[model samples]
Target: MSETRVHRADVKTAHQDLHSERGALRGEHPGRSRNPLIKVVDLAWLEFEKPDLDRAEVFARDFGFQIAARTDRELWLRGTFAGSPCMVIRRGRTSRFIGPAFHAPERADLDRLARATGTCVRDTDVPGGGAAVDLLDPSGFPVRVVDCDRALSALPEQRPLLLNSGTDHRRTNATQRPPREPSRIQRLGHVVLETRLFARALDWYLDTLGMIVSDFLFLDGRRDRGPTMAFIRCDRGSVPADHHTLAMHLGPGTGYVHSAYQVTDLDSIAAGGEYLAERGYRRSWGIGRHIQGSQLFDYWRDPDRLMLEHFADGDLFSCDVEPGWAPMSTSGLAQWGPPATRDFLGAGPSPQRIRDVIEALRGDNEMDLTRLLGLLKAANS
Candidate 1:
């Protein structure tokens, strides 16, 4: 008997010429600055306000984070890495994303930034003993820069499983079944945000944190409108860094989009998704490869409806790589995977979202009529 075979249409041929043309634009914007206060090392953690701490804690544990410290009013969660606390949930009457904390390259960088930004440098009382300079970005999000002095005992690390391929098998007489246990999260990778001021926010991030743009996405057929979205990375000279430590896209409102944590590999993501499913968590999107940073991704919503992502095998770029330019389109967001859903696009045709759009249109912000239409077109494309 012959085996059943299935074939799909070739998409590469359709986009081959466009890919070649865009490839030529790579490295056009290295985005290295001659003088800045300090280069941001990495994203340290995020803070959120949740109404129910107990319910939030359950979701955190199932999402593969261990509780580092807990109080009646606050909870600190940490990954397997030595970083003491990667997340903080504070009890509040209403739930919302507070902001993110970033690590500077050095202890002195904290002082430098404090003076430059005219903000006071004070000691942090959080789980990690550190001094922080807290300030708000142009988009009204709280930003914390800290120099950690707390010592952390490293946790056990989970390694990726070796796989046997069709042509060359790596395992001999060994059957593999990934455990249903929670996939260990290695560390915090990045956070994405939506802002009403695209150019201002982009400039502020670049100038203040010394970050470089890894890629830029503009509205289709509107190159002159400039890039509405950017994948920005820290300027670690000669040292390889994740393709993007922070990403921002122009939208009708300013708020947190999602945060990504690094996992072991593809197996961990799939198995972890299963664990989340068994625990009755909602999946937002993914189990696919992204085009910009090239990370295998899986997204989920926590108990408080905050979006989080587990990713692995992402691209790393040295400071020399120039930023790539591309058009923003729904179909171009992923390399291969299930088609993006409206929920994933943050475009669910809900009444609240439509009201938000109406509010933005009525106000004088970046998401003007033209920009809103452009974004709608891009999402539908």
Candidate 2:
């Protein structure tokens, strides 16, 4: 497939509307800012510390992330999002902050960012090869921005891995073989985070990045019928998108929350969920339509226990769209579900994963990811 690229389009200075002046550049968002023109990209990742390494691995594989490599302490998983690892299961319970990943145009962007932010920045070379830079944000999570070049190997099986053939007779062929995939992220949509300092977080994101609020949620904080959650867009003047790339909600935590990955369709979501179950993973929450964003979502736990979301058919807003606010309601968050639960938002690292994390953190002798990656490279060669 031809390369998928983010094109530049004339967008209004979000700062001009939000603030009093036309601050900063009237030119393209510094091609050297190490931040892509983000037209619309998936969150790219959410690293979680899993207690049960094996379980986390099984869970992510079932949920549809291609297991890229694994070590005694970490497991890496990738999806349709180019060569980017959509999820990483690190071995500590200490990792907080849901850092959103933005794909920039080139390494020069990172250089530009170092100068713009006046922060000493560096790149994390891929374990095997290539490199990317981690951009720090006000929230403490380092928003990783990269002009990446990673390759994806096709799925080994086309049939749903976890679902039984008995459910659909036509699926009998699934056990046979897989078909070739031409490569495209298809497209990655947006992500939502629950924040304790919702207003602070929302303002920081909007001011630093050129995001416009498309809509919002306000709960009964008295007659203050103001917003509690905000959904914003990266406004691409003529971009044909109906997806909000980022959203913030009022909540207890101040860390990196859940991030979303977009697939091709509802079929991919359903099939991937079943495949995950067949591969032996605990389904987190989903196969439900969220009321707020109006996106059909599926959530699952990866081997590292981080939440992985698959979404499609979500609401979108133009860059110039103003913020719309409504009272927050549990009943209004989803169109369908058995009702939300505490564990629904906080799915504990499973029994097995918790133990694995403890040992790894305690300085246990662990297998390294490099060995496994070496084996994969040799096999492919």
Candidate 3:
């Protein structure tokens, strides 16, 4: 039996006026930790590659993320996610893991963290209800801070749909569907990453972001197994969604992997996925339901080989109870869908004859080992 790990992490955070729309839920929940005000109300992660950064700028504008700043190296974008810039596209041949944007409870919290962890904390202003600082997590991801409440999604236009006395479906063609939305974005959810430091990375995220592990992926280290993935939560007060604002795992290499944008429903996820597909972008995996976050999702590969996703209508939880963990396996990751078919996305196919290659390639100074190794590995067995 897999040992069931228990997490009673100790925390330290500045005191604050815990306000809320329906009243601060944590203010009432018993056993809720009093300190470590780890409510991540925003995200400010980096995009590894700046390939077509201009185009990404256009896409961000079309998708509803406000442009905060753009130079040759980084494209900073903002949104309703919080007060600070929500996403940044840093110049690279491809995207790499930069880190997450977790906000602080107050200015004092920033000071406290800087004092406690010795991370180089910085401050900025962008999205929320108050000021913010940058938090360098234990795992080395850059976390931006802000004191804004996660505002409600202001969907363009909504009306109650009613089916009254013998409403004819065919005759309602003109007014059949809801009003059109131009690639509307509802909220910022979690980001999944590829990393080299697995356990170290996990602890860093949990400790810094206050993310409760909804589940952790385990691997048998055998067969053509699937990569294990983790799911986390972020309680934004008004909305009971912390359905993995971020997740991480071992990397083929390291850097800002990819980010996910949330829409209102599954149809929207499909719509966005279809739009990206029509534009000739590569898809990584998905357009299916994930058992962890329980969100309807679709995945795509961006210019830098990072997998981006469009997700919607994830399950909401108010129980404040984090539960579940599973071993990583080929068949266990996806509950339903075409089997994940990426050579590099979910998991590598199998083990290799490393000893033979190590001897053959010894002192081959002319060959670029990294490039040669990747090509050889990507090829047929």
Candidate 4:
């Protein structure tokens, strides 16, 4: 019998340059783990500390989140999905992101994670009673794995509008009139973070939570050094999951970049954007489709200047799908949109960012002069 073979040129498309199998053949990282503590089901919620609960509540409503629970000191925001609250904001002296909490499938999974990490599970006092095991990632970000007994019921759905396309008329004679209101967020989609210790953090998430990479992006001339960014998805076996539940990139700063929420469609994004604009909220960037996740997205800043995103129609991949690889560049961010903005890129000059660069260079982390220069080049390319 003849041997079977497949050529890269035969399978490669103009859009995709590499896949996990080929990357492994080239001696690149496999982007996953052989063994892990436990596989998390989904993101539970993100915690934040804001100075004013009143102001936060106002923005939360205007941003299309329903108030799940609120107190004088804390405010819990939820989406239309039947799950946990999307976010928990507490009163604090300064406004900053606390961390993210992921949902463990079973109580035993939490026990397994706790035992593996040498940490103990503690009871949570949030709206839904739960137990959580907290641990810090390699980059000093707090990560919590939780198992909650109670789940929030689904709210009324924001139905997508029917449209007429080429040779297809879904909407008969009805006029398209999406109301100018806040985009009703369905669920928390994903979060993007920047880390000075990219390699360590990336490995920690994979090994600890059993996450698998959906895509890997490397600097043009630094492929030998491995990927500088990864879009990671939860390991749901044969079940399809979001393309990325969490994304991390190499950068001088080690903190949140932006978090995204799923909306209905492009009409929701446009109408919701108008609502935010009329309310005098600042838009960072977006109203475009991204190449990686294929999400129609719009980015805005809350009153505290934290970046949040409204997105819809994101890609979903099963565990069988191997990670794709591409070169990182500003132009590669979107398939069709305005050029990446300085605010979205975090390229605008700021004293704190300058200090972060200096501190990262001085500290013993993955970031260095050459890597920083490579990132800057990739950002401006």
Local accuracy by lDDT, each model: 0.83, 0.53, 0.52, 0.89
Model 2 off-target regions past 4 Å?
1-42, 71-74, 81-83, 93-98, 127-135, 149-189, 221-226, 275-281, 302-306, 316-320, 345-381
Per-residue lDDT of candidate 1, residues 144-226 (tens digit): 98878884667887778888789888888877778988878888899999988778888878888899887788888877667
As for candidate 4, its clashing pairs are: none
Clash totals for all candidate models: 1, 22, 20, 0
Predicted candidate 4 versus true structure: per-residue lDDT over 1-381, tens digit per residue: 323223323333322543332333377878799998899978989999999999999998888999999988899999999989989999999999989999998999988998898999999866879999999999998999998889999999778998889999888868887899999989999999999999999999999999999889998888889999999999998788998999999999999999999999999999999999999999999899998888999999999899999999998877766678888899888878888899999998799999999999999999989999999999999
Pick by TM-score: 3 or 4, better one: 4
Q: lDDT (0-100) at residue 298 of candidate 1?
A: 95
Global fold similarity of model 4 (TM-score): 0.95
Model 3 spans > 4 angstroms off: 1-51, 59-74, 78-85, 91-95, 119-121, 125-139, 146-182, 220-229, 235-239, 343-381
User: What is the C-alpha lDDT profile of model 2 across 1-381, one tens digit per residue?
Assistant: 323221111223332243212222233121112233332232445555656678766555455557667898988777654556655667765543346666554566556656666654455533334445565554455666655556554443333334445665554544533223211123346666755455666655654444556555544432132355676766455453454677775533344445677666666777666666765666677788875457788876654445557877676544433344444555555778656544555534567435534443343222123322332232232
Residue range 1-381, candidate 3, lDDT tens digits: 323222111100110111101211232212123344454543544434465788777656545466667788778775454345557677677445555656555566666666656654443433334445555553456656555444323434222244334655534434445443334554566677654445556555556555555555544432123223455665455456555677775433344556787666655555556666666667777767766666676777655456666776665644244334444444444557655555334444444334323533563222235433433343222
lDDT rank order: 4, 1, 2, 3
State TM-scores per candidate.
0.91, 0.63, 0.66, 0.95
